[model samples]
Structure formats: structure tokens, C-alpha cells
Target: MLEVNHISLTFNEGTPDEKKALQHIQLKLNKGDFVTVIGSNGAGKSTLMNIISGALFPDVGKVTINEKNVTLLQEFKRSNYIGRVFQDPMAGTSPTMTIEENLAMAYSRNKKRTLKLGVNKNRRAFFKSALATLHLGLEQRLNAKVGLLSGGERQALSLLMATFTEPDILLLDEHTAALDPSRAALITNLTKEVVEKTGLTTLMVTHNMQQALDLGNRLIMMDKGQIILDISGAEKQALTIEKLLHEFQRIRGEQMGDDRAILG
Candidate 1:
């Protein structure tokens, strides 16, 4: 359960370059609710994610997880209960660490540190089983450095690491946008599988309209620093690319200008 209440943020406030990234944005996610977010460039998609993840503090309002205020919480402090996968394949993983080592670190999240080794016989077995679910043969290369893997492989590993601890909230910021279509599809399916299996509450930001519609039980479209549309249940299920575009035009009184969103 997460709540973002009347949060607003602006950069370079009162200056020539001042821009409002978010304005009185409000969102709430029930337990196991999966919401897909869509928007054109500068529509505050990633900005909203950053606010939730504690990478950026809002100028007003507050964020709460399970009814506890965390607006001022540092990103590291929130990491214990939040799992995130960035658009970049390299962002979420350690390039120099072995596959097993990276997984070991994720497995240790929120646990008290001790003198014990991060990886052992039991942990390795668990990591192997987990990696096997990716179907990428990473379980057999547990000793290999992450940098040597392909982009898709690295992203898959990143997804696994993010979900390994079963954090209360999962934030995916265009996690598959960097990969080829085939690989993107792979990661997308994996995302659906993992979320359903773990019942993890998730918020995913994506430019692809089809992807926005295909995944999640709910969908929201944002523009000009505000959430323009939020649809769920039957309404979300009945949505099509044409209907979504029409809704945007109807709400904003203008055409969607982002070509990527239109073609996606």
C-alpha cells in the first residue's frame, strides 16, 4: 500500500529556466495493485517515479508507505522496502561483481549485516533456482562478471535482483526500452510473471502505449505535470490505443505530440 498525496515539485524555481515537474500529483496503490503509467516526454512520468523512490523530494505534500510518512526519507533509507529497475541495463547492477555476488547483495537487503559470507551453499542453490527462472542460462555463469553479459542478459539480471527481496513497492522506469524488440518482449513477459507470482505492488512508466495497455490492472496517463487520466478495472481493460489517444485529445484539448508514444 502506497499513497502520494498532493505532491508537487519544481526545478530552478523562480528562475528563467524554472519548470514544474509535477503539480499536486496524487496517486494511491493498494496491495498487489499493478499500475502502468504512460506519457509523452516531459510529462512528469519519470519525475513522479523519482519522487516516489526518494531520488527527488517534493516541494510540498507527502509520500506514505503503509501509512508511514516518508517524504523526507533518503533514497537509501527507502531502499529497504522499495525495489526499482532503471531504463539503463547498467544502472541496477554492479558491472564488476559476479552474477551470484550481485544476487547475494540483493538477497541481503534489509537484513542485519554479519560476519557471514554473502554466498554459501544454500544461497547459491537459491540463486541458481532464481536465475533459472529467467531462462537465460545465468545460473550456469554465476561466477562470470556482469559486464561481460549482453544488454538483455544484464537487464534480465537486474530485474531478478530488484524482485529478489520482494520489496513492498516495485518501480520500473522503462526497463525494456533500451533492448531490441525481441528482448523487450522477453523482459515484458518476465515482468508480468514476476509481478503475478509475487503479488508485488508495482508502478511502471513506459512510452509504449501497447505495453501500457497490455500489462497491469490499472493505467494512468500524464501530461504537463499532472495526471490527466487514471483508469482501472473494466475501463482499463476496455481501453485501446485509439481510445487512449482520443481520451488524451479530449482531456488536454490538443493532439498528443510525442511521436514515440503515438507509434508505440
Candidate 2:
């Protein structure tokens, strides 16, 4: 349901600090396809996500969702159909807003605004039900300011908010990277559960190799602003971490140098 065609982006062009962020990147995701992206730092994983989400427009090529070209659409406009959770738990949520208020804003996404109050009796019930799915007891803290929550709780809430409406495409940019192991595991399980239940088309960038192998139907490896490897189906299923590392070394002719990716 999403297509990125020959997309390329550069920063500080024609200057001493100019660097190519993405080069001729082409990707396609069918409806309900969950693709996991893995790479070292500066590999253009987040750059690709930003381009797809409309936070950055590629200098070349186009992005199409459900046959509609959205290459130049503004970020807020794309929010109607694109759901994203950032690396930082704090990025997705407003520290000042209460739990229910944050959820209420997410619930109102893509819907025409009106004079009606944002949160009501029925909406509260719905928000409570949704929060209950996170199993974080946030349903009991609907009025609590989000800043009061722990990192894991806030990340869980962010995940819930992003998927609340089942947007056409979901972008997860190393979302669990900031959490401890246990909390990361919790969010990972929740991600799998929500995506399976909703059948949302997803692109998740992660430094964790095991997570990339375990979660998605397809796997992509990027380096130096280009996709170096794309594997799926039985090939992806049969892949192991050792083999993946070997493949990276083989294709790129250099060992993967990012310790975080290797150790994750």
C-alpha cells in the first residue's frame, strides 16, 4: 500500500558539510506487510522514515500511499494516514497533557473538528478500554499528567496512541531503543500484538538485529544511504543473526562497525 520510488535526499548541498542521506531508495509495502529495517548509524534508516512520513521531502522521486502521490504533503497532513512513534518516549506525548487528553487528541486524528468537547463519557470509556490493552494500569490514571509516567509507561502509551486509529502506514523509528531490556520486551510484544490484530502496514527501524529477525515478514539492510540487502519469505525465515552479519560483511566488504547493532 506504500511505494517509495527512486527517492534521494541530501543535506547541506553544495557546501563543505554536504552529505547524501539517501540515494535512489526504492521500497514497496503491500497492505499489512510488516517490514523491519536494520542498519548502523548514518545508514539513512530514519531519513527514509522521515521522508515517508512527510517530515522531510526527498530532493528527488515520489512517495505514494494507496495510489495517491504524497511526496510533497506536509507532515501534519500526512498524519491523517500515517502513524509514527519516535525513538524518544517523550517525543510522541505531551508531558503536560493527561493520559485521557493525549488519547483524546489521537482519537480525533483525521476526523473533522467540531465544537464538541474532546473528551466525553463515551470517549472516556473507549480510551479506558484501549489503555487496558497495554496492561500498564494507565486506565486508572486517565487524569494523570503524562510527565508523571515512567519511561516504559510513556512508551506504551505512545504506541497505543499511534495505533489507536490504524493509520494506513505505521513508522516506528527505533522506538524501543531508549528503554531497558524488560521494558523494551514489553513494548515489542505490544507492537507485535497490535500490528497482528489491526493488520497495519508497518516499517520499523531498529538497531536490534534479533528484533529485526523475529518481528517482521520482510527484512532490509541498509548502508551508506542505500539498501544493500532485502530478504523475505523463506529466505528471511531461514536467516540467522550470524548469517545476517556475514551477509553484511560479504556485501559491503567490511565488518559491521556499529557496536549497538552488533550487541543489541
Candidate 1 global CA lDDT score? 0.95
Per-residue accuracy of model 1 over 1-264 as CA lDDT, tens digit each:
899999999999999999999999999999999999999999999999999999999999899999999999999889888999999998989999999999999898778768899999999999999999999999999999999999999999999999988999999999999999999999999999999999999999999999999999999999989999999999999999999999999998999999999998
Worst 10 residues of 1 by lDDT: 106-115
User: Could you tell me which residue pairs clash in candidate 1?
Assistant: none
**lDDT values for all models:** 0.95, 0.95
Prediction 1 TM-score vs. true: 0.99
Q: Give model 1 RMSD, 1 decimal.
A: 0.7
